[model samples]
Target: MFKSGLAALIIVLLANAEAQFGVGPPFGVGPQFGVGPPFGSRPPAGFGLPSLHGDGFPGPHPRPHPFPNPRPLPPPRPLRPPRPLPPQPPQFSSLRLCTTTQLEQDKCLYALDIAGNNSIDLKLECVQTDSFDDCLQAVQTKEADLVVADEHEYLKARSADLVPLLYAHETLTSYYIAVAPKNITLLELSNATLDVNAMDERAFHAAALFNLHRGHDLCDQAAEGDVTIQIIDSADYDPTDDELLICADGSVLYAGDYDYSECNIDAGLELGIFAPRPYDTNRSFTRLLQNVFDTLINSLGQESEVWNFFSDFQGTSDVIFKNDTSGFSLIPVNRNGVTEQKFTSLHCDQVSLDH
Candidate 1:
């Protein structure tokens, strides 16, 4: 029994010595017991460890993936084109002018044609009336939009609610000078014979000044005194050196040598283009008139006989505007008033009369 035990102990020591001496399973055979490889040996295929040479037996090492399975980004949304903007409305479609006579209406139509040819964007139409009062009524009732007339005429109708938009002259003052041998005062001419050209438009304007100086109404001179006022044609009337010549400021008799600052009667009035209060409030309408006036004035020297802005039409005198008008100037806003006092209060020098 002791000899058999001794042999069994020898067999167990031999197995332990083989493991400690770097000896293991035979070639091409896996370890029967769970044991690790030697220090210098490579791990078998299909193991978790990476291979040192070439591709590993299982497969190439997968690139480190931040996400194991990622979804592809959706196709970039197509850029939406910007939306289109809407159209804007016009400031004004058209402008209408008021006229008193058929000849005046014809002149307005000619002015419209001239505006169209000159590229002025204003659409002007004319409304004819029986008389100047009827024209004012048409404007007040909105049947007409504007009127070109003497400022005094407009002042007579304060209830018409009209406003001056532009002036046809810088200074509308027409000087009435009395020429009487340079010796007699204007008051002394009460009993003297006063000669005036009947055909002249200024002859009537001088009547007021004559009445002012003489301190009596010349129209009813027989009731006041024997102030013989003779109205004769300009060509036939020849004044003697002793007679009185109450003529306009720029009359040919003065030879441009007259100083009207003294011995003169100034009628401070103007020819203006006027409109209703509502039309005056529209800045666009004001701009349109300024453009139209500037265009017409610029075309004055040009040779076009079809239209004349400042001349007589169809044998009529001062059809739409005064024939003596040189140019136009814009009046200050809100300056139009019911009384002549308001107009006389304006400082003509300070006002911006520019187009």
Candidate 2:
């Protein structure tokens, strides 16, 4: 039957007309085939429809989608006006003070903190990533502001014309040598085996082989042609426990490893893998200045006293301060340009590869 017909029948039955309203009939039996529920009579059972429950009455009534949520809502209480959220710390327009390692990144941050925002609203971070060939890639990709590495590596980079923003002496202790026989020296040997390990395997090998070759050469130079030395293998040899330390009994000369420096007195071997030989000559420092010196020079023009906290460039009495007279030109100006300003820690290091 039509849907409208079914609805009409239901309405008529609900009206409770004993004499029949409009459809001429005795018991008011208007046919509403396939309509809604039966009003006067019970509906037929067992239509064989799927039921949710085993008892078969449309299974469990689908729990209300929201379960009706009939519970009374708690009354609202007077809210203490939210303490005005602490004023957001003034955000510096991000500046990229690139360096290597999150630790080095801390240098930029700490230095800025010392600079104290003096209108230099550039945030800085250090990056630990791929090689300079990759442009310290993380920074090249703008993951960091500036980047840093060994002055030697930096030299290689600079030679490529990619100069850093700053340069200053940094105390380091990274160069080290690992060997089983603790006191073996290249001068004391005809030939010996070696091993190398580092984050950059190729760079490590280059450094390793360079030092080894220089090791043999430098010994003869320092010894005035008295020492004769050669590596155990002409082909690169990996260090091993069984590796031999062929030496000339007592002619221990510096091969530039752990505990051995220009003096080459004798610091003992860094047995086993490179782990124990943490010769940090160029690694750890109170402060290391490295980067494009021009960048720091550029910061001098900003009106902010913040640059006062960075390392001083060129000379002690002079600094790179921003020129406000021309409206913020970052150039290295003498301290005479700044007024009512005090300089804080300004560590500097000189880069050298004259050797």
lDDT of each: 0.58, 0.34
**For model 1, where is the 10-residue window of minimal lDDT?**
346-355
Over 1-355, each residue of candidate 1 has an lDDT whose tens digit, in order, gives 8989988887786576555533544433544434666533555543434454445353366677899799999999999999988654336556678888888888888777776877655457889998878988888887877787664465544557787888776333334455555344444456656666534544443544454445554344433323455443333444465555554332324334444443243344567788877666677878877776776666641234545577676777667777766777875322111135533222122222210
Candidate 2 displacement at residue 29 in angstroms: 99
Best by TM-score: 1
Candidate 2 lands at a TM-score of 0.25
Q: Could you tell me the TM-score of candidate 1?
A: 0.52
RMSD of 1: 13.0
Model 2 lDDT on a 0 to 1 scale: 0.34
Q: Give the range where candidate 2 is weakest over 10 consecutive residues by summed lDDT.
A: 268-277
Each model's number of backbone clashes? 0, 46
